[model samples]
Target: MAGVRTSLRRSAPALLIFAAIRALGLVTLILWSHAKGKDPHQLLSARWDSLWYVRVAEHGYDFTLTAPDGRVLSDMAFFPLLPWLEQGVSAISPLGFADSGLLVSALASLFAAWAIFLIGDLLHGRRVGITLVALWGMLPVGIVQSMAYSESLFVALSAWSLYWVLRQRWVAAGILASPAGLTRPVGLAVVAALWVAAACQLARRNGDWRAAANRRMVIGAVLAPLGCAGYVVWVGLERGSLFGYLDVQAEWGNGFDGGVAFAGFILDRLTGPAFLAGAGLLIGVAVAAWAYYLCVKQRQPAALLVYCGIVVGLALCASGYFGSKPRLLMPAFPLLLPPAVWVARARVGVIVAVLSAVSVGSAVYGAFWLNGSGPP
Candidate 1:
């Protein structure tokens, strides 16, 4: 308990900054929504995916929506952990399902920030750790961290799982990765990270294969994919095919197309009045790719590199959901480390000034965004 308090005290600055940044975003969103005569609480806790999650919690997977085009929208397409959590929270408190989801996300975002800070500190120093958290909280889609979404939960789990993998605590890593896998489809990234890291660890072992430590490494790898695979198999059984989950996603117009669809999306934008949007997307892709390259150049651990690659690849290469790409990439927090390191090396005033500016910018953008088309 003493150790836990010490760690929390150390991470307090990062947590506080993160909370402040998110609070700014929420205040801006509330003011923006009121100005537009929209309900701020609804925007955060009851719209878009939030509604779907609440429905899944209140009901079971029995609800299916038929789109106007006659496609079946199975509630199963959403992984179950977030809805399960909403149910638990609602059953235990006065909060309704949607508000419970909001509460879950709020707590999860702070946990995610702490895990992110620890990862940065593990690789660099405390300064970099704090900067990394600040940068994550300043992301344009950072507002999503405050919404009734699973991104924060997934990131919290993924980051902690990766941290354990980095520390060579195989069983703990696997334990965390399990729930992470259940949180989002992209939890596949967490599974891959654990497996790859375990493989590397085993390869470096110059002892017997049956050693208890090696056994745990194997166990971690084996346990990593169960959550995702279990859900997928369940969906498959329910949908009457082994590929049922893929079918459901296909109906929802989402799939991995190896960037073919995304490139086409950018081209379409470039050929129209949205040229700047296309250019911005192109730059975003370039920046992400360059950051990955730097991670490689900096020799980040295999797990970190693999996890970031898979998350970003999935987000960018999805065949549809063009507008959600930014929010989708929120779990790929490792990409923020390079810039975090640079910021850490700068003067304190510069760091504070940059973080403050981006935070305010994020606040405005988040308010504008939630008030506009919003997350799909």
Candidate 2:
């Protein structure tokens, strides 16, 4: 109990920072919705994929949509953890599925903020941890963390999974990765990180490979892919094909294309009327590259490097919905390490003021974007 209190006290700053930023964004969204004659809560909990998640929660899988041209949009493309959470929470509470989703996401975002703090604290110190968490909340697409979406839950699981890996708690890491797999496709990154760490441990055992193959490591590795594999198998069985899950994603124009399509997208933007958007995309790419370089320079753990590398790679190489890139990349928390270190070196007042300004900007931009272009 004392340990828990200490952790909560240490994590308070980051948690408060995240909550404040999210509140600002939500308030902005409320005002924006009022001006546009839309429902604020509905905007967060009823639109887009949120509705699909609620459908899956209230009525099991098998929910799908048929486009005007007859293309089948299956809800199976979405992983199951978030909906399962919504359903479970709603079953024991009076809240509806969408409200439960929102509640879960809201609480999960705070947990994610805390997990991120733990990672940063482990990597550097408490100050850097607080800064890192604040930076995450200031991300332009940070609003997604508060929506009835799975990003928050995935991030929380991913961060804690990485934290367990850092602590060399292999079994715990793998267990966390299972839920992460159930949350997002990029959960593979967590599995790869654990596998890479285990392989490294085995490599370091000299000729005693057998000694390195401990029960914990073996069990962890075995468990890591279960959620993803199980869901894929279930979808395949229901759809009458082994590649049913892939087909579902393909129906939505999503697939891995080695960044070829993404490159073409940039080229199209460069030559199109949305030149400003293109410029922003280019800047984002440059920033990501610079952050990766910084991570390399700092010599982050191999597990982190592998995990972040895969997350960034997958998000960039995805073939559809270029606008979702920022939200998709939100799970790459290590990317914030570089900026956190830089900011932590500054005066506390400066840190708070700068983050506050950025938080405001994020809140306003998130509100405007959601009410206008929306997610994806």
Candidate 3:
């Protein structure tokens, strides 16, 4: 209890910074929505994946939508944890699923921010940790952090899981990672990181792989994959095929083909009328590649590198909904560590000024976005 209190107090600054960032996004959304004659709360609490989660929470996962092309869109494609929490919260509270989800996302994002801070504080210091939280809040798609989505929950789980891995708390890491797997398909990255870290430890141990340390590692390794595997297996049985989950994803035109499909997407864009969009795609890809190179150069911990690499690989290689690439990559928080280190050394006031400006831009963009085309 004392430790928890101390940790909270230490994290207070980062939490406040996170809150301020989110508040700016919310206020911007409200003002923008007022100008456009739309409900800001509706935009945040119900739309896109937010609506899908509410459907799941209120109606359960026994729903599917079939397009005229015979493509099947099933609720099963959505992960279960966020909706499960929404259902549980709505059951007791007067709030509906949408409101419950917004509440969950809002709170989860704060926890996610704190977890990011813990990793930063451990790797660098409290200042760096605070910067990391601010940087995360300022990401272009950071507005999604406030919506009723699973990104916040998944990031929270992933960050804490990574923190536990860094602390060598094998079982605890695995325990947290289990829910992460249930939150998003990329949760596999966390599982892989834990396994890679454990394997590296065993390799370094030379012998006595069955020692206490190795035993804990073994237990964690076994536990870490359970959430993903269990869900996939259940999906398989429910759908009456071992590859049912994959098939469902394929029905939605989402698949990993070693970036072949994604490369084709970029190529198609170049051939289309949207030449500017094509240019933007290329620039985005280049930026991602450069940031990853920095991670490698920084020689981040193997667990972090493995986790980040898998997250990026999955986000970039996925075939459809190319627009979601930014939001999908949002959970790869470690990628910001390189930049956060640089920002931490600057004048605090200067850093805040820069981030505040970026925060406004992100907020304006987010409001305009949700009120228009919306997330795919």
Candidate 4:
């Protein structure tokens, strides 16, 4: 009990610091959007990518598309977890659908920060935990923390699920991962991680197969696959095609067959003075290398390695959604933990000051850039 209290007390400072950084980043984004002569409400409520999510929350699944191609795209193509939360919030509160989405995202962002701290504390120590939260809060793409998007919610769920798995709480891990599956397609990565972790535990046990722990493990194993299966079944029923969700993704130019083609597209733009394209390539490479480093040097848990590899592989090998690579990679926040732990140990004050400056400046720039240029 005393240990639990001490742990909570130590975590409190990191939690408070993360929230403050996130709030600052969010404020910068909102203010920047406002300054661009854009109506904040409209910006918040507008029919961007978020519109599909809002549609799902408000109207449920309806298979229709207005595009020239008679492609049957429905909100079912998106997982229902985030939009369901949005709809639920709006149903109960004075907030409308759009505001509800934002609210869900805001709460999810805080949850994600807390989860990141937990994972970091487990992997490294208290100081590293604080550093990890701070780094996550101040990430260059931190502006997304405030948007009516599912990234925060997904990250929060994914982080905590990983934490539970690390703590050997198989049932809890499986439960958390189920919602994660509903939240994003990457949730399968968590499922895979949990399975691998469980299998390893079972292998190491030199007992009868019907042990009490094995019974609990079997229950967890069954629950882990339900979330993704449920979503897929819903999509099939709504669209009259088992592959309907895959079709919608393809219609949106996000099919998974042309990784090389996408790489060529980026390479074609590399010769000229397209600084943005060059910068994007550099960032992509850097992120990939960093992920690899986490996999190797950090000796990350096997589950985490499998999770990161699967998601990163899918994203990199994916063809049509090349533009969304950064956003897709954003949820891989656990990969940042090893480096953050190192930074936290070496001249903590200097590292914090440097990261804080970079976070604020990059966050402000990212907000403005995203407003003017749109997602890359």
What C-alpha lDDT does candidate 3 achieve relative to the native structure?
A: 0.90
**Candidate 1 lDDT, 236-282, residue by residue in tens:** 99989999999999999999999999999999999999999999999
Off by more than 4 A, model 1: 374-376
- Please report, as a residue range, the 10-residue window in candidate 4 with the lowest summed lDDT: 39-48
Using TM-score as the yardstick, the better of models 2 and 4 is 2
How many backbone clashes can be found in candidate 3? Answer: 0
Write one digit per residue (lDDT tens) for candidate 3, span 1-376: 9988998999999999889988988898899999999998988888888988999988888998997989989989998999999999999999999999999999999999999999999999999999999989978788899999999999999999999999999999999999999999999999999999988888889856678887888898889989988899889999999999999899988999888887887888899998787788889888888898999998899899999999999999898888898888899899999999998899979888888898889888877777786473
Instruction: List the candidates ranked by TM-score, beginning with the highest.
Output: 1, 3, 2, 4
RMSD of each: 1.1, 1.5, 1.3, 2.4
Which stretches of candidate 2 lie above 4 Å from their native place? 207-213
**Measured by TM-score, how close is model 1 to the native structure?**
0.98
Q: Considering TM-score, which of the candidate structures 2 and 3 is the better prediction for this target?
A: 3
Residue pairs of candidate 3 with colliding backbone atoms: none
Between the candidate structures 1 and 4, which one is better when assessed by lDDT? 1
What residue runs in model 4 are displaced by over 4 Å at the alpha carbon? 1-8, 44-47, 68-72, 206-208, 273-276
